[model samples]
Target: MPVRTAVPADLDALVALELRAFTGDRLSRAQYRRHLVSPHAAVLVADAADEGLLGSALVFFRKGSTLARLYSIATAPAARGRGIGADLLAAAEQAARRRGSRALRLEVRVDNAAAIGLYERAGYRRIGLYAGYYQDGADAWRYEKPLAVP
Candidate 1:
């Protein structure tokens, strides 16, 4: 369950996890490659020696902005309920903080109770809602957490 910044070598596993974890709004292989080197983005992955990649969290930051966006987070089907999501989340927050972000924001599918619970348990507050936010027209709940300065 070691979580680390994703590298180019992790591209394949990252894409695989993305495909296995979500049915829609999936990140393409090219996007994963781009994010791996993007100065404004951080792709963090949780991997094990035998399990390959357990999960990944993608975060985006903007110049001069104190807020970072948790663009996506996915845990492999076989790795769910193992706290991998939470671990990836904590790693994402840390990545954002390292970029000088004072707050982190994310949008989760309204029907995804497990994700909502994870965010809530991590101290993220429901800020608002976005209508028809997903590819399948599912609404999303906006959540935000203020990161304490370290």
Candidate 2:
């Protein structure tokens, strides 16, 4: 598996992966295409040796600050449990650090225990909660991890 910066051509596959990971509230092909062209966004793709675009991470830069916000991360259903998510996250963090970000932050659905676990394992700490953060009225757990040295 390889982790690399996403290109506009990868939008279709990313949309497919997003649909696979989240059965509800999926991003359309148009949204992904726009994401690829966004100036403040850094998207990474995880590609397999045989298959392509196994996973993706979309990181958006916070305005007027050195912080990178993880907007979304999803791995293909068939690619789950294979560390692809981990790889994509690592890439995102590294890219954020390279761009002078002091920390990485994101909100995970409170009901998504598995994703919370993954974020915890990746060194994020739950800093707060947001009520009704999701489209379906689900709450969110905000997590943050420092990217710079003490």
Candidate 3:
């Protein structure tokens, strides 16, 4: 899989994929559009050979900070279990490192075992918990990992 910064052409597919990937608290189409051009955010898309988009990862690089947030990551249903998530994650970490981020952070639903496992396998460690973080009143586990400076 080839991971690259998302362009405006990827908007519709990204929006549609996220709608199916998350049951609630999904990013809006407008947000995706902004991310494509936002200086503080990096939106990456994973594409397969002749298959278009397989997943999208959004990371935020806070100004004047060494921390980058792995704001959102969504893989298409047909592309799950194919290592797309891991690839996207590694790509995010590398992108963050290039931008001077020393660490990457994210929040995941406490009940999402698979996602937690993926993050952990990628070296993210749980650092905190946010109560009722999601719109549907679900708690979130905060995780962070040190990024190797590029």
Looking at model 2, the pairs that clash are none
Candidate 3 lDDT, tens digit per residue, 1-150?
A: 889998998899889889878888899999999999999999999987688788999999878999999999999888899999999999999999999999999999999999999999988999999999999999999999998895
Give the alpha carbon lDDT tens digit for every residue of 9-102 in model 2.
8877888788788976677888788778887888899987689889999898866889889988888888789998888889989989887899
User: Against the true structure, what is each candidate's TM-score?
Assistant: 0.99, 0.93, 0.97
Flag the better candidate by lDDT, 1 or 3.
Answer: 1
User: By descending lDDT, how would the candidates be arranged?
Assistant: 1, 3, 2
Clashes per candidate, residues 3 or more apart or on different chains: 0, 0, 0
Instruction: Please report the candidate that would top TM-score against the real structure.
Output: 1
Against the true structure, candidate 1 reaches a TM-score of 0.99
Clashing residue pairs in candidate 1, if any?
none
Question: Considering lDDT, which of the candidate structures 1 and 2 is the better prediction for this target?
Answer: 1
Give the distance in Å from residue 16's predicted Cα in candidate 3 to where it truly belongs: 1.3
Rank all candidate structures by their TM-score, best first, as comma-separated numbers: 1, 3, 2
How high is the lDDT of residue 19 in model 3? 85
Candidate 1 segments exceeding 4 Å error: none
Give the winner by TM-score: 1 or 3.
1
